[model samples]
Target: MPHTLIRIDDLEDPRIAAYRDIRERDLVGRKGRFVAEGKVVLNVLFSTARFAAESVLLRENRVPGMTHIIDRIPPEVPVYVASGDLMDAIAGFPMHRGVLAIGLRSEEEPAEALLARLPSEALVVALAGISDHDNMGAIFRNAAAFGADAVIMDRTCCDPLYRKAIRVSVGAALKVPFARGGSADAVADTLEAQGFQVLALSPSGKQAIEDVERAPRCALLLGAEGPGLPEALLSRLPSVRIPMRADFDSLNVATAAAIALHRLWRPPTL
Candidate 1:
């Protein structure tokens, strides 16, 4: 096992440039991968062999529940320990939960690539403008648990692979295959061309989600919290609504998507 000790006093040392501008990845441009904070998030990440942690940062004394997590990492992987302040300086945040990790950025994937991997039995979730990281993350968590095939999103949606989205999803975002780009209409055009029906989610939509016949191929189109589906999308695609309490304005987009997916996409009994 190899060990490299970094002192808290040397905060500006450039040995680890990747740890400095943590927020740069939040927007866009030539940024590195997302950071997974805390032991709980890292523990969730342990299941994903696809994500390789470039490094792990830990507090000197260590977190209570994370001793097992540290043992799971390969002996050769770089693990840095610092006092709380030092940990924050490296991580660019104050809440240096006794441990942290840098999760590898996922490779860019195309919708066609995702489409090709589909089994005859596949269920997928579609999201648009779900710019809120927490919502995007929660939706992914639910999708992974319920057996959804993929998450399709427009370019405007937040990066599902971003740090916060991954943390919020407990890293379920990584497990789910997602493709971003193209408007609902464009994605619909491609999906339709691929023989999928674009079921647009909306409140007043005439068709109920349960009423729709499940097909071997289907895409669930979702919008952000308040804007609802793009007006043009409704005109071009078949609009469907989840049955809900009439008095409520609407369910949160992630929750609504979960309910609809469960009802529409239950795997057939063998």
Candidate 2:
């Protein structure tokens, strides 16, 4: 397959506008687009059905090793190559990986639609008010690792498609099926309506996680680290706590989620 590698000699070229000032754009802009950095993430971006690349920016020297990957990109997509210094100038910092792709967000099914589509026996991770991008990304990574059917996030949660979150998840943010933007209660209600037994994780709960038997379909609800789940919500659901020493009250939201997900996980058989 023929590859079109457009050398980026001028930093001011409008074609590479999306790659400029990458950090600032990641913070307040990007519209419905995202950055896929490093070779690993770029590979996932190309393969993921949920996303499509508008263009790719790569260090000219790094193209040799990425030939096969570049060849796989749809011909309609432009491939831009720049010198290391030029790449650094455009990004406003050293992006050592030298491989970056700008991808547009693909539409996702609604939470209710996604829930109704789940297999009869499914495990889901629900996040409420998880404002930290790192934690959100880690949760998504853990969800993918544990074979979670889907991850549902409330409106207050950070965008998992943010560059840092996607990088931290190592592209799991793209691989894992997810739905965002709803009130916490609304999310829980949707899960319950789909015949999912929702379990809320709290440090003070009477039941140990191990003691709770797995349901045919389960949705584990987690919240931001310090505030944890709201008391009103906690009171309504069966709460389970992880056993820990008295000195520490809780684990980071992401770590706690991993533990709970692993315990509840039932891997699919061939």
Candidate 3:
């Protein structure tokens, strides 16, 4: 197959506008769209029906498996090949695997959806104000590993679909169901309405995580390292502490989510 070439000398080509200004993806911005970089993440996105490709950018010359991936995409999906230098410049970053794709943005369900859809028994990880993209990605990865049914985050939290988070997550964010949190009051009200036990993880807590009685549904609310859960969330939920080494005050958010998910959630015997 002859290579399909795209020349994008003008950075403002509307066809590839979604790939421009990669840094702005983290901030609150216009419509939702996510760029999956590298063949691995791009392939993962490609395999999913939930995410549809807006366009694809690839480097020219000896790109492997180009035929296989292209066949998977419908002809309607736009494919553009460019020089390796142009690929990097258009993406505003280095091309790790010499391939990148822009996909339609999607959001995780809200708490109500998670609560209603979750089986009679469910384990969920709720994140509040975890601003770091790497941490957000790691949280989803851990959530997927330990059988957490859903991930809930605050509105102020970083966008999980952003490029960095998607890379760090290695596409686990695509698998784990998540919801944006509304407000501390809203979180408490929703949990109370759903009858889920909200166990907020914080050092100031009195109860050990092991001691908490497991319910049919539970959500572990984790916060960023320093600020911890906001005061309102603390005041609302029953606080539980994860017993850690005295020398170390806390684990990384991802590790803590993993440990919490493991201790609290395990698949039932088939």
Best by TM-score: 2
Give the alpha-carbon lDDT of every model. Answer: 0.76, 0.90, 0.76
Per-residue lDDT tens digits for candidate 3, residues 141-176, read: 888778888887777788888878888888877777
Expressed as tens digits, the lDDT of each residue in 1-270 for candidate 2 is: 788799889999999999999999988978889998988888888887778899999998899999878978999999999999999999999989999999998786799999899999999999999998899889988988898989999989999999989988888898888997489998999999999999999998768998889798999999899898988889998888999999967689989999999999987778
Clashes of each: 1, 0, 1
RMSD of 1: 2.8
Residue pairs whose backbone atoms clash in candidate 2: none
| Angstrom error at residue 196, model 3 | 1.6
The TM-scores of all predictions, comma-separated, are 0.86, 0.96, 0.84
> Could you give candidate 1's per-residue lDDT for residues 119-219 as a string of tens digits?
86677787778889899999998888788888888878887877788778877886888887587667777677767767888996769988888777877
Backbone clashes in model 1, listed as residue pairs: 123-149
Q: Rank the candidates by lDDT, best first.
A: 2, 3, 1
